[model samples]
Target: MTAPLLSVSEISKRYGAVVALEGVSLNVGAGEFFALLGPSGCGKTTLMRCIAGFETPDSGKLTLKSADLSGVPPHRRPVNMMFQSYALFPHLNVYENVAFGLRRKGEREEAIRARVSELLDMTQLAPFGARRINELSGGQRQRVALARALAPRPALLLLDEPLGALDRKLREETQFQLKEIQRKTRTSFVIVTHDQDEALAIADRIAVMRTGKVEQIAAPIEIYEKPATRFVAGFVGEMNFIEGEIARDDGAAFVTSFARLPRAECALPQGARATLGLRPERIEVSRDGEGVAGRVEDFVFRGEYTLLRVRVAPDVVLRVGAYDGRFAIGDDVKLTIAPDAGVLFAESE
Candidate 1:
């Protein structure tokens, strides 16, 4: 197997007393589309900045192709960042904006024009070569920024919320185009975004972050199906955190108990305090019957599926998705969690 393209080793960062990242280590393979995903203030941006050489880490090392990147200036590194704001030059037209970096490197005018035109054509912005930045739409401007960032043909590309500025429809369309571009160019892309759908749609692997730390890193489907922590389970998608105490472990299985549910099966773990995490969609809802009975507090008829807020207990209101059956508010429902689908997370962590 080929060596990893990038390896982050025990990297830590701090803004005074506030710890922004802690011993976070990850590896990215060549040509892989990696994503850093989390809500705001989770240090996702900080980690990306560290990788891009915009922010220096307090401890540990960053390596690209086994070479340390410490003290390497952002401009000197073989990595380029596409900012969230799409920092395109206002005065430069599309061609000039895309050619700016090539010119700075002292490339001949013919080479600059050729490369610029090629990228413009690739991004489908060739016809807008003479248009000023202000004349273009948000998606157009975004493509310009991408072309500029990719102009130098950097080995690794870091994108920070690159689609946040566009409308939903445009963003969705651009997402596919971005993925296609990456695939064709074979550039190692690292994108940071809080939009789960965007990350799931484009990324080869996602590093889910929370509170300055990485909660989990895996393919989107694996992250959704088997979350490593409670934070990850709740962050990636809607989940019901049912408080449960481990009743027994037979070295191969576990049992849990709650007031409304008894002996719920879980993965074997020798722990007393734990929480059962079940995804909303993993639950099967039916008329009040054998499973845990609950009264539907509210029902929303979404286009593809229905969302029900079920009051299972006085204090716990679990969100459940019903894709088939339609239930009215105050309707009694039976909530059943697939025994194999429920995940057990150790509460202490």
Candidate 2:
């Protein structure tokens, strides 16, 4: 395997009594699109600042390639960070904004012109180079910011909530553009975002953080289908968690709930407390009365699919995804899961 382009080993940071990052360690492969994902105050932004040299860690080390980056100034580090605000200078035109960093570094005017022109073309902003920053639309401003960040040709590019400034539709469109730009430049990107959908949509690998620590790190599908913990399963997407105890039926592990659920990966001993995570899409709903009984409580018609909330027991409500809204509220239904539908984890987790 090739060596990672960036490595963070046991990095920790604190502000007064607040803990921002606690022994966080991870690596970014060369040219890989990596994401630091979590809710607010989960240390993702702090970790990005540490990597960009804006905030120093209390302990541990950060290295780009093989060289240690400790005490390296932000401007000296071979990295550029794009802020969520897009931060383009209002007085400057798009071309001058993109050329700012190169000019600041004392690059020859000819080289700066070439680099800025190449970035503008690569970012699809060649025609808008002469436009004032205030005249560009939100998405255009975002592209300009990205182009400016790339002008220096850094080895790594860090983005903090890159699409936070745009509307949902534009953000989705820019996600593809960002991925394409990364592909063309082949620069390692570490994006910090609270939006799980955004991370899943663009990152090659996602590190899910919680309470100043990493909860899980894996590909999007693995993080969703086979979450390492209950928090990860619940946070990454919609999940129904059933509280139960592990029981053995014919030497096979099963979760004793409203119904016996056979799980192949249950490692706990018999009678151990556990939770079964069921994705809404994994549960099949039908009115044929062929599976566990439930009553539809409510439903939402999403364009692609319908989401139904069903009350299975007095205290248990499960969300089920169906292709159509065939069942209405107050309708009786049956829910069934595939043999390998759910993931099991300790209840304490």
Tens-digit lDDT track for model 2 on 20-59?
A: 9999999999999999999999999999999999999999
Name the best candidate (by TM-score): 2
- Candidate 2 differs from the real structure by a C-alpha RMSD in angstroms, to one decimal, of 1.3
Cα-based lDDT for every prediction: 0.87, 0.91
Error of 1 at 274 (Å): 2.1
Clashing pairs in 2: none
lDDT of 1 by residue, 184-243 (tens): 889999999999999989999999988888889999999988888888888887888877
C-alpha lDDT of candidate 2 relative to the true structure: 0.91
Best by lDDT: 2
Q: Superposing all C-alpha atoms, what RMSD in Å does each candidate have to the true structure? A: 2.5, 1.3
Model 1 regions more than 4 Å off: 248-271
